[model samples]
Target: MPGSLSAYLSQVEEDGADYVVIDTPPHAGGTIDAAIRAADLVVIPIRPGPFDINAAAGTVGIMKQTGRPGIFVLSQVAAVGPEGDDTAAVLQELYPDVPVAKARLGQRKAFMQALISGQAITEFDRPSSKAVGEIKALFREVRSRL
Candidate 1:
């Protein structure tokens, strides 16, 4: 099982896949290790809360150990509040080497609706919707980093 993920990723690459996004659970394990090893850029999603911020340290540690660059994207952030900014500041202060993304996914119904419909927010929501904008901006930032 240790090398299974790597082998699968290798096959995906062989099949001309442009990118492979592996969403691992918020815990330490062989699967997470393998995913980190195979990643070109690890995108860590952190919610604006004390527990989420603290939990992210483990993933950050893994990234450092693997020497893989990563960015922290704020997820499910409130539309109007200081929590998002405060969290970003804390993340930057705690991990000066890693960058916190400017684009944040806000807490909106569109995201849940998209999930229920098995579609992305860009596809499920109106083009001019804020949720769509947030996703697009995040994609652009992630693309630039890659």
Candidate 2:
């Protein structure tokens, strides 16, 4: 599987693809390792909770093993609360090597609504919507890292 993934990623690069985003499950395994090996930068999403923060260690360990850089993006964060900030602080304290993204994806109906409507938040919601802005900010952060 790793060989296949490497081959596919090579083809994607040769085909002039600007980027190939690969989403993997939280647990560690061959596929996850292979994806990490193939990735230039890994984006680890963490919800605002202790369990979620602890679970991220495995992926962070894999990234370390492969000597690849990664950034943590807080997802499904509460719209009004310190949970998001506190979680980010804990993550930074625990894994000082990995940076946390400045943009937090707040828990919003638009995300689910867009999925149900088979459209992205950028398309499903108005441009000025918070969800749309959050998505755009995340894109910028990820792009800057790449």
Candidate 3:
């Protein structure tokens, strides 16, 4: 994010690119504004926790003002029990137009293990508890929106 991502995005579109993804650090700034200006959609990742869900709302507001769609990905959720309902209710209350699908990335030790070893979950161990299944499902939803 050296300058406005919008500047780069403008250049890419001029060159006939279909899409561009710009990852900025977890903060709001000139770079974020630029990226928002350039994007058709914004994807905000929120852990299934109160604080994280609140943060996702702020991001969605930015996208709304910028005339871009903002999607939420709930991560680090408990695999079972009442926690899912709590998180889902919070999201449903906020951005009902954007579908918060039932699929999620649960909290798991294997994810941390893979990250520590500098490998993707699929590349490190596809068969370990099958979190890839969840990731794949999430990707499909995202793809359909795009």
What are the lDDT figures for the candidates, one per model?
0.91, 0.93, 0.74
Off by over 4 Å in 2: none
Q: Could you tell me the lDDT of residue 69 within candidate 3? A: 78
30-86 in candidate 2: lDDT tens per residue?
Answer: 989999988889999999999999999899999999999999999999989899999
* Tens digit of per-residue lDDT, candidate 3, span 1-146: 63645577668889998767777655666677777767776777777778877667656776778788767777887878777678778888878866676568888887789899999787776764568777778778777778
TM-score of 1: 0.95
Candidate 3 residue pairs in clash (backbone atoms < 3 Å): none
Locate the minimum summed-lDDT window of 10 residues in model 1: 1-10
Per-candidate TM-score against the hidden true structure: 0.95, 0.94, 0.80
Clashes per candidate (backbone, < 3 Å): 0, 0, 0
RMSD of 1: 1.1
lDDT of 2 at 38: 82
Q: What is the C-alpha lDDT profile of model 1 across 1-146, one tens digit per residue?
A: 65778788889989999878999987958878878878889999999999999988888899999999999999999989899999999999999999999999999999999999999887899999999999999999999999
TM-score sort, best first: 1, 2, 3
Q: What lDDT does candidate 3 reach at residue 124?
A: 71
Residue 85, candidate 2: C-alpha displacement in angstroms: 0.7
After TM-score superposition, the amount by which residue 100's alpha carbon in candidate 2 deviates from its true location, in angstroms, is 0.6
